[model samples]
Target: MYISNVTIKNYRGFNNLKIKLSKLTVIIGENDTGKTNFLRALSLPLSNNSLDYNQKRLSVPDINSNCIKIFYKSIIEDEDQEIQLKKIPKVSVTIQFKDVKDFYETEIVHKWLTDADGEPCYEIRYDYKPKNDLDLLLNVKDMLKDCNASEESKWFTLPVEHYEYQIISSNNEKQISFNDLKHVVINTIPAERDDFSDSNSMKANNILTKLLVNTLDDSEKNNINSAYTEFFAAIEKTDTFKKILSSDADFENLKDYINQIECIPNLPNLRNILSNITLGYGDDFLYQKGLGERNLVFIFLLFAFYKSTQKSFNLCCIEEPESHLSINNLKLATDFIYKSVNKSNRLLQTILTTHNPTVINKLKINNVVAFNGTEAISLTDVSQNLLDYLRKRPNFDILKLLFADKVILVEGPSEEMLINTFIQTKVNSLNNVEVISIGHKGYKTFLDIWLRINKNNSAKKIGVVRDFDNQQKAKEDHDVYDAENENIVVRTTKEYTLEDDFVRAGDNCKILSELFGTEIDYDTVAQSMKANKTGGMLKICDAMLSPDKTFDLVLPSHIMEIVEKLK
Candidate 1:
């Protein structure tokens, strides 16, 4: 079974985070918003990975920097008592599970339950503490007990050389570890790392080597070793070697200096020989392939290897799948990852953190989580038709709206182009707010994202800008998006369409009519725009780019309201 819940506190860049994980969970956010930190934090409690212990160990850097700052500030506030009862900042992560089955799974999760006698639960907890020993606080206070200004200034750096941490069972108040058993494993593939490079051997290649070691039994290994040893022993006795030796004997001084130098090839066995195998297209090995191609192949091979080898639950955390990938290759890689987990018989779970829109386009809405530093946003109860529609058509840039601080949704490309120009030129160029034209698929569906997120904290502002066929439809649109507390504002064109409204706006028709170099009124301009929407918008936008020209084409008040409100 997969891990259902993860609760994190004061680790890496994450101040605090709690999010339920789907079997194939995708975390999308801009860089350094704790997406990678979230992945690293989830890796703490998991065991049975090749480098999990070494990678999971806590250091001074592992503790949240802000938490450390507050800890240093809070320590010596009370001078007389040396230390008060303020709780020292500590980092802890607890992962709860669902769908746990079988004796070993039950036994493993049983030891790490949150409560012993209260309720049936399954969780694994890890904590990094401030006080490694009883006298830590007292000694720290005494060190800074009495010091001059100069001495005290130097002593402000009160961080630990190394922090002590432990994995403990909440059920029994005892230190615990899952390393002794290979029941569960977690493997992390980092972004921007050349794991398959020849200059630096991949640390993860050890897993492949270990798998080979386990696969071949002792007798088979012995036979392979014997064959290599015998072949090496026979090399010196060959006729070619005898002739070379005889020739060396004639050169007495050289032969005397050498005494005896025998050729000994490196012994090959199942254990270490796999590393020597050149993998890739014939001449170009894995290290020599293009970075993107190598990365895709590396990921594909990794998933296949895990699928074949894993018996217990396996969780693979991949960060930034779109690194160095072309569109086709990225599609293939993402498709493989999702399909391998869901369609296979093996228990392989994947959690991905990405900055790429293509990754989000390939995933289900329910499985994608927006990591906005406040709280993760996950789509729930979304219709199946919409979910499949997103995957089928990747052109919709839902990801841009997901990451923006504020959003402006419009009807078509004409509105998108014009509004963007209007914002950049007329307004002060509000950078945080984004304008996305959703092609008029459905306005309400896009609002569902803000609905899930604004529930917790209604800080994210969303402006829905669309055109109505009639004034009656505008009233219905207003009623649909009329959520005051939700921070959403709906603005529709006063007339039937954006073109109709634009023609009706003050001096906009005169300006466009002058630019078109012909006499045109509201009806002619509106009908022409409706027929050739992109063509009409492109001509106006192309002229707006020139610094020598200026057109006082006023926008509809409602359009400006959506843009300015989001701003």
Candidate 2:
């Protein structure tokens, strides 16, 4: 079974967040946006750890409610025996917490429902309460009543304040011990993973140790122990050991004091010794490698172990995999994760949270989830054709566009390069604003994508800067020419293009001659500019911003307007 969707309410920063998950989901957002919380929610249900439904886990805005609910939609195989018996196509698990008037009454309620393919299915509810002295008295009274020999059955009542597990199912409701659902395993690689730490080294060792231990049967273990005993006995008979004992005075004294001592080996002891041995390259241990390489190795090692031990279903949730990784390593790690999940023989699902642009750029856009502090917007909600168009563009960094506080969409590299310089000079910083070049056409398609994203995240400010080309017909047909949206600003040049606007705003001859490394007349420069707009604009913008040059250069009012909008 794989989780198809998750809903979290009043947990951490999420008031009510629901998101559809994929086989490989990549979550990206700013810090403290609940990216980690989302991962925790997914693992909480399947994990063996107890839930602490305290003030810290409650959303501050809804603290008075004192309830947190996490719901999951798990897609199960229809042919599975358990699913067939339950007569359902999917499984739904709901974990809820309710804070009663007294702290003693606080309890966790686990509810399981089977999705009967559009029909009503069975629902099972398990309520777990804390244990106390009051529970013991109620148990004795209930036992007496069951025997039907109670003289004061009316005088004794079942206590409400007690540890209890009551399972209410469609067939019957009764008190039963807590039982976990089968065939589900959830593992999480938290955000604070440290590869060089001693604890992390032991964790890696433990994973390998567990895998090795589980793979060997009793017969194999016995064979290993017998081999170890023979090896030890052979070592004792070797001339090297005899020579050392005969030559060393200390050995003779120890042997005299001990009378007799023998080196014996067991399977467990040998396994322990081997588990403590670190794998390395030549003289350097694995932990001694570079941080990024060590992290990658650790992840792959753990993943291999996890895959080997899989039962029926597994979920691997990793947070901030970009941590301690360089851009090249980040790309490699993402590719590795993607391929691992897509392996034909592996029944594995992966959820990754990352902030690296290289990682985001390498993933399928449809699998990306952008968290905006309170809500999550998946790129799958976008038109597939638009995403396909974006995927075809090899240079576009969509993460920058999605995560930036404000975005400036230009036409091509020349505008993208020049506008970045212009904005840096005007604003003294480009930290909050991102400049993206979308080429000349497809402005509307790109704008629509941003518009959908903006609808979900209202805090983003987007500005589109394009040229009018001085064609009346083109101006009339420009989709965003005079368009206005709440969070989006569109600005177009007043002249034929950016080149014509530059010529109109300042001295064309002086700018062109200084930029192109030649003295050319105004008509000659204009002809050249028209012939090669991008090349002319690059030279023009560069010369205007050059340190050795000084001129009365006035930016077009519209260009300055878009810059201000972005600011």
Candidate 3:
């Protein structure tokens, strides 16, 4: 089953909100930003509210008990306007099952605790008065009557029991859990503290136990070690895994145990003993490994566990995947996650949070989700050209001025020359100013790279510019080009040669190009613009612009004309 959407109201810091979650949703926010609260709400099973706290494991029991109430909504209809039209104040959730078994079991169960007047319990807290409570009681009673009578009323008022499914944990100050209300498994990786042991199996256990599901005999008191041992055996066959865990007596026992279960192949080699084997490092063996290696282990372990469980759809949420990795290693991690999700033709959603711009640049544009405050902004909204410029010029920091801004993206040299001149002379006081060159290459490659970079960072001002070529076409057909338009700003130039028009029309390229002289050819003019002394671009432009014959050689006016146009 896949979770499509979640609507939360008056839950924790979220007063009233709706979010359409992606398969891989990377919830991003600073500390105390309510991201955890959002996770807890989604992780709750539809039947959770009806059960007493002690009846089952709540992924976030403290939250379930402490928060007065919570609301959940999901898009149920594939193409039903009635469902879409039904908006806020009415909450709903829908889950789509891949198998017939799940489809039959899927149901919408709502949980609400309201006063007689229909006001939610928490809402009444702020404006609790004798009159308000009386009115609320009446409203809730009417709502309850409607629920009892309506055919579509699968909704459950609070203090009602349905099913038990959710996991919550309190280790240190950090809390973690998995709720089934929206079919999302939320895992809050615990941060290490001074009192924590070097190899605290907290996070690893929480995740593996759920992933193993039936395979893990949780009814036993010592299933943790056995579960981990099984998970390790599942992936140990691959050579990549063996190098991480050498031969050991305990490993042999775990492998023998796994062989008995038939989930993994038996390995009788002296080296193939333990299931969960890790390289030992100084005093703190667990913390000593490089972050990249650790991240790799984490991702591989996750996939292995999921594969072992045979779950077709998985929503994998990770935080700061790049926390301790180098750029190269980060790239590897990215590839692994992408490949794993897309492999076996199964649907696996991987969502992660990061502040690293380079990582954003490497991802597919649409896959990148950027966050500012609590808002999840879409990067696809930016123009393709602008995205291209930022990708090529990765060092350029444009995050501060991307939104509500005017951005100009151009190809190198000629396009830059023409547009800079035009903007300076034609466009008056551009509100938020930004200019970028995606490179002199074809517009398609430029657009592709740009979108990839900008897609993940929504706060980038993006635009595109392409050459007229010989056809004098702003945007043309190129079989070699891949990016298709609707996102470019095309500009046509009439010239025999690609570089000719701008080179000929300048004081350098700017001045004459600005005039748009009919007879000028930039290539012809550029030849004469070269400076005799310094042999540099600025000098060449200055010499052409100068009135006096400063240079020893006397070049013709047409030759000096292009250089003079440059700014």
Candidate 4:
């Protein structure tokens, strides 16, 4: 069974949020946007560990509501049956919580006792009244007096308040054990993992020992024990052992203690003998490696052991798997995570939270979830064609758009370099914005890219700066594009092209003539600028960088307007 959907309400930072799950889901967002909280909420129902909802997981806005509900839709497919007769059941598990004081009075508790919805509700309910005859009489003295009861008479009986807790399924309100849901296990690899820590090493050892115990049969265990006994006997016969027995005071004391016992212990138990074994490569321990290498080795050992044990799990939550990883290692880790989801005999779903573009770029765009502070917006809403186009375009770095506070979309490399320099020199306040050159694709294409990016990152400001190709045509069609989007700013120039605009803005012809060491007129320079656009722009950019000249005199007002809008 794998989770198909999760609904979280009254949980930390998530009042009412529902996110769809795929085989592999990549969650990306800015810091403190509830990415970690989202993962914690997912692990709650499937994890056996208890979470303190009131203190740590409760939403402040929902404190008055006094409850937190996390609902999951698990999809179970029956492959044992024929395809025509197969059943795919969508099971629902609702984990509800109420303050301890209101545990009994909560509506969810009441529903568990009386609701006939045929869905399981795991909650606490209670039945309370008076306890015993004397206690009941004392509690209801007026009723006892009305009934003519006395100390000699039989004391009236009444029920006392007591709580009952169970996992009540919808099937006739039958109680089921929470262990019945053990098939769905949630494992989390937190972001702050330290493989070299003593606790983590112990955990790894325990997991390895458990896997060994479970994988080996009794016959194999006995064979291993016999072999270990032979090795022990050989070691006892060694010269070193005799030397220790004769010279070491500790060995003499151990021998004396063993003689005092009724029966000396046989060979140490094989399981306990290897319990303290530490993994190492060659002569160096795994912990002695670099942090990044250790993280990779630890993660690999965990997943490899998990896969070898043939255990099934519903969901795996991995936070920042790219942490302390190089680009190649990050790719390897992400690929392993993706491949593990569709393993042959297991149903595993993975949820990953990452800031690394290497990981993000490797994932399918449709499986991405972008989290703002208030909500999670799925990038699957973007047109598949556009995503496909982006995938094919190697030069387009979508991470820049996703991570930047604002984006400036231009036409080509010349515009990119010039605008970036301009922003750096003139508009120092807008340092968080990125200048993206989307090639020579016209204003419509720039708008299309802007819209696509806005769909996923609507909170970010976008600026589209394109040259008006024809001055006469622009005058007739001033409303060619809508200027109504509050999050976007569209800037157009009245001049024929960027080159023409540069020439008109300042003494560009004079600058070009001085740079090229030739006498060039204004019209000739402007026309030649179009013939060698990149070369002309490079010359102008170099001039701007020179301490002898200042290009600020030619700064365009529309460019400044775009930067201001972004700010």
Candidate 5:
């Protein structure tokens, strides 16, 4: 079974978010936009206390600040709105598992199944709320009301004092312990884990423990336990312990005061000793390796551990796997991850968050989820041909469009080059504005994404720039999306193309005339620009931005509209 969807409410960095996941999900978002929190959300319902150590007890700081503020606001508003105990906000997370076809998966989720007969799916939910006692809830509300009336506001102290966190199966709303869900294994390797100093040994130990889980099996562990038994006997057979026992006769009178107590090597459990195992690489230990090599080793170890161990379901979540690696190695790492997930058993699934563009190339667009703090937009329904077109060209940094507050998408390289030059030289500094080229007829897909991620958000603007091969169809394209979308401004060229519009825009032809340093007419320049679009546009851009001419460059009206909107 694999995670199909994740819903989070009032968790850290999110008021609410829901994203549909795939087998190999590549989450991309700017810093603090819920990419890291989305990975951490899985730890709530699918954690194994023996494995994951980042699982600290939930506290007030873990609650979303907005939810706390709203709770207080509801308590103070008019004093007549009947605030029920159930209406109090709760910080929660839900993970839904799908495709339970095999016996192993079915047995694990049978108790958690919402529907045992239909296409099988299961949900496990976690909630942090005040206890479900009616009298205690009433007392909690009274405390809040008293605090509100006396003006002694209890900051950062509302949810923790009276709240308890619980895990419940959605099938029958029955509470379950972490041990009950031991069949699910999830290991999250953080980004900053290369430091192996004494102070950072916890991080170092975490990586090693995960590696050991991949390296050792049940039989190997049993063999080690038996070997430890024999090894401890050998140490006890030495003369040191016999000397202490033989001296009992000499201290017979002292023995009456302090019975017979023998000194021996006192060690903890076998697993504790194994946890102290040190790995060496070359001359130094594994943790002592350089950053890039150590990180690559971590990836290899996680991959090995994820596939080696058998479980009902297995998941590996990584944050910024591209940390401290060269571009060439990043590509290899991404390719390795993609192929490993593809070739492994159906039980193995991997989810990772990355800021590096190369990490998404091999993973493809369909498996990527763009998280924007409050919502998630995925490319699951986008055309395969378009997704492949972007994947084949790594030069196209699609994450820029996802991260930008304002964007303008063009048809090809010519429009991209010309528009960027114009924006930089003329429009001053639009720091959050970006220009992306997605070829022709690719606006609908990204626009649909923009509409989803930016819905109910602040007025983040996006412009669509394309050529009008036919002017009548161009107006239809502009009017349809422009009227339907408040965040989008679709601007198509009035003439046949941007080049044709440039030839017709006032005094713009003179710049092109000076580009070749020849007496070329406007119509011929337009025709030649069409024949060689990128090269012709490059020369035009060079003349305009780095000019040796008397007059300034004048942008075409259609192009000016977009530039003006950007400004």
Candidate 6:
């Protein structure tokens, strides 16, 4: 089962947020946009000690040092309107799990310390039912405390203190702890190395002790270490270090010599199933292994461990999977994640965080959670209306608004793109012009909107650029065009002489091949363009450069050119 949604209030960076998760959800944003804290919020539900079967009391897990602020219901009107801030070490989450087709909801609460009044620490609570519904309230904390209080009873009380789950550490016979229960609920997605801090080693060890039986077996571990040492020594003997080692194997030259052999500091012990193994090496050896290989090994280990699990994880939290991986490798990593989930017997829900645009673009738009500094916004917000409209209507261009501004309707994307480039690069300050391709039928539709709306100063200025298909028909076009309309203009190119099907400008084609005999092979470029399966010539920017960089270059160019011509 996977968590379907999360809602946050008065948390770090978010005043209020409610987000629905997809099977594969990706969070993307700039630095300091609270993306990391968002992950912490999700972890809060499971972080509660009551869920830990082990009764060891510890501070709430501080993924980050910044504490969340809380407020009680206020009495005064002004105080109620204003934020009544309290140092909230306590946080709560409402976790909803899906089985078959139905949803089950539960609450997990965490607290940092006792309140100022010396009262029981205020814990965050996720109400399962709507406030107005008025049903029997279920308090997870009370249920857990009750279970811990009674041992002889069939129901085991959840513990009220923090400790790793007893069941997790290799002993199959141990009674389940609250910690084990929490871990089971949270383990929807396999944990990636990037998701945790250096303390991750400790956490990982604890997790593996429970999941991988061999990890807790002393005999198995020792035997694996011995085998690993032998394997390493044999591999080293084939290296340059081996030549140095044999020469220096001389009984330390008595007291005068130290061990001069340089070999890999340590190799991963293979005895433990995938998750429990580590490949530690000296800094010198790190350079010998490429970053790609390091990431590959890291992912392979996770993949192995994930495959080894008998039970499926409910949620997997991965941070920046694109790190140290190239574009090609990122795609491969994404494919691997997709395949890994599909292979699992249980429903695998993924929470992947990334800053890479390629990874962002690969996701179905609805699955993306975009952070805008303070909060995470879904693509659904922008596309909601379009998505609704499309249920009955097929073949609708939802992104038609992309060129909806004071549109300068043109023949096609190639022409629109070229005009945009020319306006921005050659023309100065064309703020009012928006270049759009109207694709014949769309041209008439846009023309009507332009005529009806351009009367007001706020309305967009409109222009039409078309091929003068035949010189004789040009008079009809010129006659219909009211020169008196200041908001609109029409332009035609004479290079084609009205006989040619298309315009032949400066370098014979819209895309220049040989710039003044430089011989750039424009045909090869055209072939490359064809290979890129996107809509129009404008997509060339996306193919050749990054989204941010391409948009930065094109928008101002078009605006400045139109502004310059209008002035």
Which residue pairs in candidate 2 have backbone atoms (N, alpha carbon, C) closer than 3 angstroms, thus clashing? none
Task: Give Cα distance to truth, residue 150, candidate 2, Å.
Answer: 52
- Higher-lDDT candidate of 2 and 3: 2
- Estimated TM-score for each candidate: 0.84, 0.71, 0.44, 0.69, 0.84, 0.45
lDDT per residue (tens digit) for residues 279-327 in model 5 = 6678887666677877777677666766776754888888898999887
Q: Give stretches of model 4 more than 4 Å off.
A: 48-176, 196-204, 210-220, 231-274, 309-311, 342-346, 394-396, 427-430, 440-459, 468-482, 516-523, 550-553
TM-score of 3: 0.44
Q: Report every candidate's CA lDDT.
A: 0.70, 0.58, 0.41, 0.57, 0.73, 0.45
lDDT of 2 at 103: 25
Lowest-lDDT window of 10 residues in candidate 5? Answer: 78-87
Off by over 4 Å in 6: 47-91, 100-180, 185-287, 379-567
Give the per-residue lDDT digits (tens) of candidate 1, residues 424-464: 67554446767887765467767766566554345577787
Model 3, span 1-567: residue lDDT tens: 334434454444554445544555444434564554554444343322111111223222222221222111212212233432332122112222222223322321112112323432211011101223334333434444534233333333322221133222111211122232333223333222211112564344333444444355545525554565676677767676665554456666666554444234355321233224443446646445655556555655555555443333444455566666777777787677666655633334455655555545554444554444344444444566656666676655443223323455555544444344434433445434455654564555444544443444434434544445555333455322223433333333444433444354424354433333324445534544322212333343444445673432222232222222211
Better of 4 and 5 by TM-score: 5
Number of clashes found in candidate 5:
0
For model 4, residues 1-567, the per-residue Cα lDDT tens digits are 334455665444665666666667899888988899777665545533221121222222312122211100010111232331211111123433222124323322344332224543333211111223333333433333444313322221211221122334342446544554444456666787665324455555655565576678889888977777777777767787666555346566577654433322364686675566776755876666677876776567656555553444435567888889987887788788667655623345678898876676677667888776667767766666656656777336766765577888787887787877766665446477799886654445445544554644456787777687765564334234435567777777657666666666666667666665556676666777777788877877776766777544465655667888787
- Report the Cα RMSD per candidate: 4.7, 13.1, 16.7, 14.0, 4.5, 16.9
Clash tally, candidates in order: 0, 0, 45, 3, 0, 27
- As a whole number from 0 to 100, the lDDT of residue 279 in candidate 3 is 37
lDDT of residue 565 for candidate 5: 73
Superposed Cα RMSD, model 3? 16.7
Worst 10 residues of 2 by lDDT: 68-77
